[model samples]
Target: MTGTRLVIDGVTLTAGAYRLVEDVSLAARPGEVIGLVGPNGSGKSSLLRAVYRVLRPVTGRVSVDGTDAWSLPVRQLARTVAAVVQESGAEFDLSVREVVAMGRTPHKRLLDGDTPEDAALITSALAAVDATDLAHRPFDQLSGGERQRVLIARALAQQPSLLVLDEPTNHLDIRHQLEVLGALRRLPATVMVALHDLNLAAYYCDRLYVLRDGKVTAAGPPADVLTPQLLDEVYGVMGEVTIHPRTGAPQVTFLPAEPHPAAPTGAEHSSS
Candidate 1:
C-alpha cells in the first residue's frame, strides 16, 4: 500500500516541567483522515509536534508504518512525513514557488536542481490548494489566508505518505476551507489534523479523538462521539447533535446559555 499507517501508542508529551498530553493512544489506517478536536490548550498541537518529531515525548512512542519515528534519520522522516503547523513565520524572503520547491529538498543531493518531475509536482501542488495564481508573489507579502494556502501547497509538494496538519483551515475563507479540506480528503496520504470546528471534523474525518486538559476524553466515529452530553461536559455548552440528512454526518448546533438574573438594583443593595 502506498498510504502510511500511523500508530500513536501510549504517547505522552510535556514541555519542560509541565505535562501537555497524557497516555493518549490513537491510530490512523492507511489513507484515513483522523481528527484531533479539542478546546484551546488541550494539547492537540503538542501531540502533533511529537508526531512530526519537533517535540519528543517523555514516554511512549510515535510510529509511522511500523517504524519508530524517533529512530528515523531526520531526512528520511521528512520524506515520510509532512506537517503544516499554525506558526507561519517566514525567516527568509522567498517567492511562493520557491517556498513550495523547498519540499523537494529532502529528495535531492547537495546543490541539486529541480528535475522535471519535481517541477510537475510543485505545479500540481499549487493547483491542488488553489494557489496557482499566487505562485509568483513574494510569500512574505501574502495575506494570512494566502500564506496558509501556499504553505499547504508546499506540504502537498512534499508528497509524504503521512501528513500532519495543525488547523489546516485556519485563516481560510469558508469556500477555501471546504476546498482545502476536500483536496486533503482525495490524497492518498494518511492525514491527522487538529481542528476546532467540530462540524467540519465530523464531515471530513473518518474518526475523531477529543482531548480535554491534555487527556483524551473520547475517541470514535463522530456520530458515536458527538452527543449533547459529551458536548456539555467537555465544552460547557448546550448543544444539539443530529445526523445530517444528506451527508449522514453528525451536525452540531450550540445553543446559547440562559441569561443570568439581573444584578440587584442599587436601592435594593442599599437597603441590604
Candidate 2:
C-alpha cells in the first residue's frame, strides 16, 4: 500500500459519434482490490483502455500518487503499472522463460545487459504463478490456462505498484480461477480487475464499481452497491442478494426471468 493510490476525475471517452464512456470518476487507495463489473458493451473495457493509455480520454485525468499518469513517460508508466489484457497473442514461439524475461524491458536501457539478478527475478516470477514447470516449454504449445498464468507471471516480473487485469479468468477452470484470483489478492500491489462473475468479484474484491451503459450505476463496497434491485435494474435480471454469513460480503444468486406469452401463429395473425 505504498504508492499505488489512483484517482480518476470526470474521465470521458468517445469513438466517432459515440460516447463510449462518460464522466467516470473513482479513487483507489493503496493495497486495495477494486472490481469493475458490468454487462457486455457497458464501457468497462473502454474505461480500462483509457486508464492504460491505449485510448486517450476525451476529457479529465487519471492520476497515480498525485502525478498525472498521462504525464509520465511510457517507460516510467510501464515500470509503475503492469497490465494483463484479455487479448494477448504471441506470434513468435518463444519459450515461457523468454516470454517472462520481457517484463524486465522497462527497466533496461537500449543496450543494457541483463545480469544474473534479472534472471533470478524472472525465475521467481515464474514460480509465483506456478509456471516454473513450463519455463522450458514452448509458449505456443501450452494450454490456454497455462498461457494465461505465464502472462500473469510476466506482468509480476515487472514488480509494479499497480496491477491491472482485464478478464484474467477468461480461459481458466473454476479451480484455477479461484487460485489465480486468490493469489492476486495476496499480492501487496494495488489491483483493479475487470470481472464478469459477480460471485467471484464478491468473493475477492474489497470494493466494486458497477458500470452500466457508459456510466457508473453504483460505486462502493459490495454490500452497499450489489442489492437485488440494483442488479435487476442494471443487468435486466432478478436476483437475490444475501450476505455470506461468515464473511459478511454480498453474494448474489440469479433467478430466471418470468416467461412471456408466445407469439401468435401466422394463421391467427392473418385472421386478425
Candidate 3:
C-alpha cells in the first residue's frame, strides 16, 4: 500500500481534432485519496484512462514510483495497481469467490494453481467489503450494489499499492454508497477516484481536483476548492456552501434560481 507515487506530467489526450483532456498534471501520494470531480463530458474518464494506461496520452508522461508507466510490463503494472471501473460484467456467471480470486491472476505463474494463502487472501477481501455471505452466490444474479462490492473485493485481492476507481458509487443506494466510500477511505493505498457526488468527494477526498472543459479549473483541499462560486461557475448551478457539523468539511446545497422580472412591452418602452 505504500510507495505508490503517481505523477502525470503535462498529460493530454486527443481524438482527431478534438482534445479530450489538456495538459493535466497532478500527483497522488501514498495514503492519500484524491477525488476527480466534474460534470458529464468533462473528460474525467479520459484523464483516468490515461493514468491507468488504458488510453495512452498523446502528450506528456505518466509515472508510477518514478518509473515510466508505459515502460512497465503489463503484468507488473497489474500487480501494483488495481482499477474498479463502472462495468462489472462476467459473462461466464462466476461465483463471488471466483470473481475475487481472479485478482490473483497477475501474481500467478503460467499454469499455477491457487494456494491456501491465495484462498485466505480472497476470503479476507470479500469480508472486508461485507460480501462474505454471498461468496457462494452467482455474481450475475447479485444486485448492483452487491456487484460493485464484489468488484472492489476483486481489486483488493490484488494487494495493490494504488487503487483507481471511476464512479464507484454509481447504482448504489445511499447507505451502500457511504459504505463503499468508507471502505475505500480505509484502504492503505493511494486512491484516485472519479466521482459524480461532490458531497462524497468533499467528505472522503484529501484533496479535490475540479475538472472543467478538459482542464483543471481548481485543485486544493475540499474546503478551498468546493466554494459556492466555483461550483456555480463550473457546474452551472447555484448552491449554498456550509460546513458539516461533525466533520467540518464542505457540504453543499443546490439552490434553484428565482424567476427574473419580465421586460416591459413596446408601449412602455416607447413611453420611457
Candidate 4:
C-alpha cells in the first residue's frame, strides 16, 4: 500500500482579490505525515483547502503523484485524495454505516450498488477507528469526537493515496485525539494535517510547516522547527521546548504571559 507524493509548489490562494495564502510550497514524501501549525487565521486551513482542491490556488500548482491535481477529473482526483474536514455536511439522520458507505462513491457508477468488497472495506475502516459500536447510531446524534472518527472511517474506505485532514482532533478527548492521530500516522498514505496543538504536531508528524499570516515561516523536522524563538514570534507566547523521553520528539510547554511591571507605584511616580 504505497502512497502518492504530495507537492504544493509555490501555490498562492485567494478569496476574491484578497490573497489568503501566498507563495507556499511544501512536500510530503510518500507515506509521510506532515503537520501544518500556526495561530488562528494563520492560513493552515486555507493552505489545506488548496491541497484538497476545495480552493484553487491563484498561482502555481498542487501535484499528487507527479501530475497536476487540478488537471485530473474530480473523480480521478477523489480516488487519489480523501479529506476529513471539520464538519460533516450530512445534516440528515444517516446511520454510521450509511455515512461511511458514501466513501465508495468515487469507485462506483451512479447507480451501482454496494458489493461485498465494499462492505468489507466499510467494516474495516470503522474498525480501524474503533467505531464499530457506533455503526448503527445516527450520525447527527453522535458527539463531535464520534463524528470525527466516522468521517475518517469514510475517508479510509475511499482507499486514497493521500489523506488530508483539517483539525481532525477537534472536540475529541485527549485519548481519542492521540488515537486518531496515531491511526493516521500508520496509514499507508501521505498525510497533511492542519493542527493547532504544537505538541501533538511534534509527536505525530515526520515534518512540520509553520505558517503565519498566510505564508510559511519555517519548515523542517519537528525538533528543528519547533523552537523557542519561532514560538515567541509566531504564537506571541514564551515557551520552553524539550525532547520527550519516550518519543524523542520536541514538546513545547507554554509559560504564562507575565504581567507588565506594574506602573511605578505610589511614591515612585508621585511628584513628592
Give the winner by TM-score: 1
True-vs-predicted CA distance for residue 244, candidate 1, Å: 1.3
Top-down TM-score ranking: 1, 4, 3, 2
What candidate 1 gets wrong by more than 4 Å, as runs, is 259-272
Error of 1 at 76 (Å): 0.6
For 62-163, candidate 1 gives per-residue lDDT tens digits of 999899999999999989999999986765499999999999898999999999999999999999999999999988889999999999999999999999
For each candidate, the alpha-carbon lDDT, in order, equals 0.93, 0.88, 0.89, 0.91
Q: Report the Cα lDDT for residue 119, model 3.
A: 95
TM-score to true structure, per model = 0.93, 0.90, 0.92, 0.92
lDDT of 3 by residue, 151-257 (tens): 99999999899899999888788987888889889988989999989999999999989999999999999999998899789999999889999989899988878
lDDT of 3 at 130: 83
* Reference-based lDDT, residue 77, model 1: 93
Best by lDDT: 1
Q: How close is candidate 3 to the true structure, as a TM-score?
A: 0.92
In model 2, the worst 10-residue window by lDDT is 1-10
Task: For residues 10-93, write the lDDT of model 2, one tens digit per residue.
Answer: 999999989999999998899899999999999888888877788788899998888999999999999889989998766547
Model 3 residue 265 CA deviation (Å) reads 34
| lDDT (10s digit) by residue, model 4, range 1-272 | 46899899999999988889999999999999999999999898888888888899889899998899989999999888999887756675799999999999999999999999999999999988889999999999988788889999999999999999999999889988988898898999899999999999999999999999999999999999988999899999999999989888898999888855777778887785
Task: Give the winner by lDDT: 1 or 2.
Answer: 1
State how far residue 232 of model 3 sits from its true place (Å).
1.0
Candidate 3 has an lDDT of 0.89
Checking candidate 2 for backbone clashes, the offending pairs are: none
Q: Is candidate 2 or candidate 4 better by TM-score?
A: 4
